[model samples]
Target chain A: MTERLNEDQPIFIQIAELIETSIVEGDRLANEQVPSTNEFAKHYQINPATAAKGINLLVDQGILFKKRGVGMFVTEDAKQIILAKRQERFYTHYVQPLLQEAKRISLTQEQLLDFIKEGFSHED
Target chain B: MKISATDLNKIYKKEQALNHLSLTLEGNKIIGLLGKNGAGKTTLMRLIAGHFQPTSGQLEINGQSPFNHYSITRDVCLIQENYNFYEKFTIDDILKISAVFYPNWNASEAEELVTLFKLKRKRKISALSKGMLSAVGIIVGLASHSPITIFDEPYIGLDASYRSTFYDLLLQSYQEDPRLIILSTHLIDEVSKLFEEVAILHDGKLLLHEKAEDLAENHCIVSGPVKEVDKAIEGKQVLHQSTLLGQKTAILYDQEIDGNYDSLTFSKASIQELFVYLTKEEVVKHGDRN
Candidate 1:
């Protein structure tokens, strides 16, 4: 996932989210050593301090931990921590927007649920 | 290393190149010095490099004036866009001279970078193309490893690929031995992300100096219907605004959009957009007087 960072948000937050997505998607597993701040800076062509800020955010949240002079490593509960965090914001970030769009379109709640079911069926 | 300028002013005959400009830069950082042409960026850099003394005010590098002070100037390396190397000297000869001038100069790194940029060692300075000359400057700046390095539009005739190479090499060198690096360039969008802090100059004055992340967090561009946009931006510091058809878009500084405003769409104002709008507003204001 070599996607470029977007301008709509802070680069460090985007960097943190990228790492979190990797953890949740199983691309980076528990206890795995993460790339150093310098590595992230060179890859994204961003300031190393900015990249360090991103890694430190995860460290503050306990999703990652630093080893003295070694490197950063994913915490054992990183996936669970990230999943729970995302789920906590799902209602506000996703559901609220979905409901607002549906209201703007004058779609009834029943129609919205049926449409979601149909969408799920297509996935199956 | 620390650089502090207090009420610094530099005037050239009838022109006021710098007007009471004061800024402090310390520690190891990659700072972006941004401004339009004739905005006093070069004057400021030259003062820091000890090229000339300021007309008034004080500039200190580590508690001492940089002007004619070898103790301070020796640690500072300022590479301008048009570096005037001896036309008769070959590329190899210039590097050798630089090795003698800069005490911390890395000969091996300079040699490697010269090869990387594909310059002929035996070619005289006068025989190189414009882009080749720029590569020579870049090589010197990076290999010097001076504690306080300043690059004022270091990339002039270099193409896109070579510019990218310069940025990479700059970061690599900084990582190896952390130092204060001041970069001044108009190509904001391409290299803005590399700066830990950004300082914008306008009309020989300091307009803004803040952390890059803080700037990204506080400034944004919001657009929507004229009435809604007007309502959304009321009481906020609007740096720049435009209207087309029935829609209005405005750049807001130090203001955040509330999600309650459903009609308004907001996006972060990139450093380039912010610089343009911030400086453009002053130009328009000046134009009104004329």
Candidate 2:
């Protein structure tokens, strides 16, 4: 069976999110070369057109830059840009879900806040 | 290359194989033909390849019927699961014959595929394993370079790694040269990523033909407490539903799901899951009519 990059979303979106995370995590630093569309297609076993679509998402966000005859490279402010975009998504993608789950189990707001603080204190 | 099937009907004696099926496909792109067994996938492929005559209506490739038409037939190649070769012929001999059949056949590419598949060139067709036979079929289908190529369950016995290799080569070759490629397989999840469009046949009729990405985006699954799930999917097209005790999950189609729910979680369904749900709806509809 083909391996899924992420089972919850479309492959192109997953591809874009994957690179965005890598940039935010500093695994792919600014000015470092990113894989070409063909490389991404082969690595993910997806169509090259789909891979191009994913890469284009980053290009549209100004997170990846393309040089003539050379492969794509991370923009100088790619990490910052990704951080900003992800922060915008953080509320819906993480915070809302967290609150919803907390409500589902009848956890009080103060209790949830205390748990979060306790959790952060133990973080390395 | 353009393939048009209008009100196409195929009847095999007493059984109806295709029912007024109509579809128009143009341009060079990969299309996945997905359906349950005996859903007229083979019938459609055979009709397009000129192996079977339609009982009614029409199917034309480039404005000409593919049946016994040498000019159009040469441009269309269909490789079925049980592809036949001379039992005594070696792989090399078969490749030589294929070159004559497919004018644009690439011998070097075939050689490369043979090496990748680790097949002995001189091995007789009868001596190869099932997986090796499937690999040979994939090699010919890819190396043929036909304008419109159809593969019906091409990777039957291929292992996961070999299957991934085939997918890689297929994408690479398609990037190099775009063509109208149709693939019919039950392994929808494995190959859905490569398809630009997907056509589903159900009960000998054209069920759906949608862009693969749009189909995935158009449907979603909502799961949680029975009451919340029911309320969330109210008035929507629920393709399938499963319930256990107080929890329930329903797959909804053509609905925009947003907002945060206290007890419900929404998730996207895989192509295979969507197929099952969609076709299951058809089954339930038929049952209701009965």
The pairs that clash in candidate 2 are none
Candidate 2's C-alpha runs over 4 A off are A1-4, A100-124, B257-262, B281-290
Encode model 1's per-residue lDDT on B1-290: one tens digit a residue: 99999999999667999999999999899999999999999999999999999999999999999998888998998988985588899999999998988889999999899899999999999999989999999999999999999999998999999999888999889999899999999999999999999999999999999999999987888888999999888888888889999999998898776657766777787899889888874546655785
- The best candidate by DockQ is 1
Query: Residue-wise lDDT of candidate 2 within B1-290, one digit each (tens)?
Result: 99999999999767899999999887888899999998899999999999877999999999999998989898988888875577899999989999999988989999999999999999999998889999999999999999999999988788999988988888888888899999899998899988888999998898899987788788888999998888788888788888999999999888876555766777888888888877863436545674
Please state the Cα-based DockQ of model 1 relative to the true two-chain complex.
0.78
Q: After superposition, how far is residue B2 of candidate 1 from its true place, in Å?
A: 0.7
The per-model lDDT (C-alpha) reads 0.92, 0.87
Interface DockQ of each model: 0.78, 0.71
